[model samples]
Target: MASLSLWLFSGLVLLVGLERVAELIVSNRHASWAFSRGAVERGQGHYPVMVVLHSALLVGAVAEAWLTDRPFLPALGWTMLVIALGSQALRWWCILTLGNQWNTRVIVVPGLPLVRRGPYRFLPHPNYVAVVAEGLALPLVHTAWVTATVFTLANALLLTQRIRVENDALRELAVMS
Candidate 1:
């Protein structure tokens, strides 16, 4: 059980690291295009803090999973794994759809229209769905219910602000379209 926890934590850390790298690359590309297009950036204050909090949640989940060694039902682990994978898929889909537009920060491309196709056609915030799924199930995969519950509650609060910023930015873009 301890070994599993270590491995799970390590894998998650690596996954997050890679995701950050992707975000940086995408943001750099977006920056060049958006600036050239005279896009104004709005509400960037909470972005860095949010990134830190999200990373902390991943690390905390890993720690809790590693420190505790309660035997989890195999069925539960499998179910959580499935949910986690689903969340990852959703996240990657968002990344693909947004391309250079997808950023971890609050970057607004003034003249560009808000995305309404793909998953966005349904959920206004498909990224939020991915976040919720991840916050709930990632820790559960290792039977770290404590981590899951606490992080989910925290993320809910943080997401409220995040969504508000995103909505405002998108709304600004919507006026032109």
Candidate 2:
């Protein structure tokens, strides 16, 4: 049971890493397309920090669980696993709905309108919501409470800046459109 839980937790982290890489690939393509038409990226100063923080988060979660020999509580672990999976679905839904407009960074194309379909219809930043859910749930899956707490706090700071930048960019684009 313990071995199985560890395997499940490890698999989850691996999938998340792969998903992030895939998102970056698509983001790069979208960024190029946006830039070709005069889109401007905001929050460049904080981008590197965001990348590092997220990378460290995954690494920390794995390390904390393995090094500390964290025991997975079935109730907590299974519940968190469900939340993590649900978040992944939400994240992908955001990506598909946004289509080519979705990018990791804030690249606002002039004269383009805000996306209001699918999940966006319900929340302005559903992707971030998914991020928050996964960040909290993933660490807790293996009882990595420190990792969960740390990542959630750090992510809150990062998201505050990111959402501010995104909203400002969108507001500017709205005027142009």
Candidate 3:
């Protein structure tokens, strides 16, 4: 049962990492297209940190699980798994609604309107909300409480900076349409 849980957790980590990589490829293409049409990217300074932090999140979770010999509490693990699944669904919805506008980095196409579709209709930064939930749920799925807590704290700070930067950029350029 322990090994099965670990394998499942490992698979989850791999799938999430692959998804991020795939998104990055799509984002790079969209970014180029947006740039050709005059999109501007802001908040360049913390971009590397953001990448590193996110990468570390997956790696850390798996490492902590192995190093700490974490046990799978079926009740907690199953609950968290459900939450993580919901988060993934919400994240995908945000990406789909944003379409070509979605990128790992902050890039705003000049004169373009803010996206108010899907989850964004209710939340200003729905992607970040999904990320926060995933950060907590993914780690907790395997009893990696330390990873969960650290990721939540780090992501909170990162999101604060990211959201502020994005909002500032939107105010400077975009209108809700």
Candidate 4:
């Protein structure tokens, strides 16, 4: 049952990984389009590093799940899945809200006001909220609480810098607007 659970959660991780890849691809394309058309101020730093870190969460989660042989608890997995699914929805809502303004990279257009609509209207960092939720839920899906704890802590540390960079870029754009 534990190995079966490992396989199942690994599959779920793969599905989410594919979705993340698709998101990255689309974001790259859209960001390129926006940049070419003079829609953003490009703040190119360690974007690829962020991508790598994000992918590593899945790798870590899967490893922890399989190696630990975490027991199968339907309630835990189902609850985590629910949170994970909700975060995905909120993430897309963020993408839609930002429109062409959004990118995995920190590219803020000069003279354009920071998007204050959709998810942003309520939270200064809705996408980060989604990310934080995801960082927690994905590991919990497989009952890999260690992964959940470690990844969440690591992500929080990374986001500290990331969010500052994003905010600085957006603040510049907001001033111009």
Candidate 5:
């Protein structure tokens, strides 16, 4: 049963990784569109680090689960699974709301107004809320507590910098407009 749990968790991670690939495809297309509109990208230095950290998150979760012989506590696992799924739903809502303005990179077009729809209507950085939830919940789904802890801390730091860059760019846009 424990081994089965590990396998199931592995499958879940794989599916999430595939979803990331799909996001990248959409992001690339959106990026091209933004560039055509003379968008300026900020925080390029952190982009690769963000990619590596996120990729490591998936790998580390599975590795920690398998290496530690982590057992799935049905109560915790089921609850976390729901949270993780909810985070994904929120993330997609962000993407759809931003439409062509969204990219994995912080590319903002000058003269465009900030999006105030969907999740953005409530929180300024609603996508980061989804990201934070997923960072913790995904690893906890299989009781990868160490991975969850490390990722939550690292992601918090990264997001601090990311939000600053985004806000700065948005402020510049506002000033220009």
Candidate 6:
């Protein structure tokens, strides 16, 4: 049962990784669109770090689950799975709402109006909310508590800096407009 659960969890991680690839494809296209509109990218320094940490998150969850022989508690696992799925939904909502304005990098086109639809209607950084939820829920889906803990802490710090850069860029855009 434990091995089967591990295999299942591994498959889940792979699917999520594939989803990330799809996101990157979309993000690249959107980035090109933004650049054509004279987008100014800020916070380049943290982009690679963000990529590494997110990749590590998937790897860590699977490694920890396999290494520690973590058993799937149906109660916790199912609940976490739902939350993780919900987070994905929220992330896609953000992407679709932002449309061509969205990129994995903080590339904001000057003179473009701010987005306030979908999840953004409620929160200044709704995508980060999805990120936080996924960081916690994905690992917990297979009881990778250590991965969940470390990722949550690291992501919180990353987001603190990330949000500041984003807000600064937005403020600049507002001032320009």
lDDT of each: 0.77, 0.90, 0.90, 0.84, 0.94, 0.93
Q: If both were scored by lDDT, which would come out higher, candidate 1 or candidate 5?
A: 5
For model 6, what is the error of residue 166's alpha carbon versus the real structure, in angstroms, after optimal superposition?
Answer: 0.4
Predicted candidate 4 versus true structure: per-residue lDDT over 66-152, tens digit per residue:
887787689999999999999999999999898877778887666676777898889988999999999999899988898889888
Q: Which lDDT tens digits does candidate 6 get at residues 1-177? A: 458889999999999999999999999999999889888999999999999999999999999999999889999999999999999999999999999988889999988878887988799899999999999999999999999999999999999999999999988974432
Better of 1 and 6 by TM-score: 6
Residue range 1-177, candidate 3, lDDT tens digits: 358889889999899899889889988998998899789899999899889888988999999998888998999999999999999899889889999899888999989988887898799999898899999999898999999999899988988999999999888877756
Candidate 3's TM-score: 0.96
Candidate 4 residue pairs in backbone clash = 40-109, 41-108, 41-109
Root-mean-square deviation (CA) per prediction:
2.2, 1.8, 1.3, 1.9, 1.5, 1.4
Would you give me the overall lDDT of model 5?
0.94
User: Candidate 5 on 1-177: residue-level lDDT in tens?
Assistant: 358889999999999999999999999999999899899999999999999999999999999999999889999999999999999999999999999998899999888988888998899998999999999999999999999999999999999999999999998864432
Model 3 local distance difference test score: 0.90
Q: Give per-candidate clash totals.
A: 0, 0, 0, 3, 0, 0
TM-score per candidate: 0.87, 0.94, 0.96, 0.91, 0.97, 0.97
On lDDT, who's better, 4 or 6? 6
lDDT score at residue 58, model 2, on the 0-100 scale: 85
TM match of model 6 to true structure: 0.97
The 10-residue segment of model 6 with minimum total lDDT is 168-177
Model 2 clash tally, residue pairs: 0
Clashing pairs in 3: none
User: Taking the tens digit of each residue's C-alpha lDDT, what string does model 2 give over 22-57?
Assistant: 999999999999999899888898899989988887
The digit string of per-residue lDDT tens for model 1 on 92-155 reads: 8887887767777667777677787788889888988998998888778777888788888888
